[model samples]
Target: MNKVIIDEDIVLKGEHLSIVFGGLKAVEDFNIEIKKGELVGLIGPNGAGKTTAFNLLTGVYKPTSGNIYLNGTNVSRLSPHKRVAKGIARTFQNIRLFKKLSVLDNVKIACNSNMKYSPLTAIFRLPNFWKEEKELDRKAKDILAVFGLNEVEEEYAVNLPYGKQRKLEIARAIATDPKIILLDEPAAGMNPTETEELMETIKIVKEKYDVSILLIEHDMKLVMGICERIIVLNYGKIIASGIPEEIQSNKTVITAYLGEEVE
Candidate 1:
């Protein structure tokens, strides 16, 4: 039998997670846990089902078998938005932003769900509506300031540089007030400098927001540099898992993903 969640520190847990399509098992027997404020890396070769596992965790794909618990609650059946409301948020492999919207508006949209004013109040510009709107504006700008995007808050999201766009996606995700964040290839298509900047951004966010993070990335430097623990996946199963040094030295991980020591 799968163990019950006895540890209160575990923010997210996946129990024997498996997903299948047709005759293929995209992810199999996946079990993992992320504790509060921990940064974990999921690394794998192409088609190793890293993203599939993320999809299962984020409610994009319902698992064929298993359970997902968020802070001790069984959330396996929640919808994506419901999951977000329950403090699980995620960024996609491809940056998904409201491209035509201003950066502030993008972040504000995510914060809107937390607003309690009804449509009638909003349409009539009631006192409660203005109060919530003013609070959301402040909160959105505060999130923007954390990402150093406050000056560009009025700029359309599409007009920002590639790096800022990545940051904005994360900022929008943060606006949802998630307990844990799933980052899907946050550094994809970035130059080394941008990657380094992102590393700092992630570090700052973790410290500032105190949220657990699970990241999927092909970038060894970023993974090894920031992750407290690393999990290697191959053929839809975990091949190795440990701290960065141990993962770097593990023969299975080296053969499967790293191919050699990262540094």
Candidate 2:
């Protein structure tokens, strides 16, 4: 929040990024630039390198070649944690919550990473430690409250309902206060109502934070409804990039994913 990525308009930019495993190229010549406060969607059929792209962007796997910039700084070589500090956060398709930890603790743990107090202060329970701890708790609760999860703050993460678990993971990601958030299949298992609620929550998140979001999801309705721009990928390469209406009308997208749009 305090520091700025050099380009105030664009939050994330990856140029000609590619990654390979064994003899296969998981992603090839992938490129994208996301503007601040923009909600973009990355969509593809299974194995279209969509998740691989997210992993590379988030530093789970370094690219075989090419550069990635965050806020205008070249961060392709940075470690995952380093990139996180530079304002990149993500949630997985499979809910990656601290299963045993309380819902509130999951968020508190994220806030802990950016704490101002020293280890000695925390170890000794100094005044500064208590001050920071109280602030952290307050901030964590505030974040969960946004998702209507504060009521179950004391329950373990795994004990929550499936949809709530997904929401919690997203909330925890937001707790990191990153400038950009990558979501992988956020609507994977949600029923229609939950998916609808998630769409609304995401809209609220965009309005409240000065953040850009890029998500990879298979749910066409979710992607089409929430994304300002949709990037379509196939065989590890982009087939099209355009607005929701344009993408839906494209013949290639139709054959690859949608059977046929009925009148």
Measured against the true structure, the TM-scores of the candidates, in listed sequence, are 0.95, 0.94
Compared with the true structure, what per-residue lDDT tens digits does model 1 show for residues 87-150?
9999999999999999999999999988899999999999999999999999999999999999
Give the per-residue lDDT of model 2 (tens digit) for 1-263: 32434566888988898988898888999999999899999998888899999988999999999878898888888899889888999999778989999999999998777999999999999999999999999999999989999999999999999999999988988999999999898878989999899889988987887789998988887799899999998878888999999999999988877543341
Give the clash total for candidate 1: 0
Give the top-scoring candidate (lDDT).
Answer: 1
User: What's the lDDT for all of these models?
Assistant: 0.92, 0.89
Top candidate (TM-score) = 1
Candidate 1 TM-score over all chains jointly: 0.95
lDDT of 1 at 87: 92
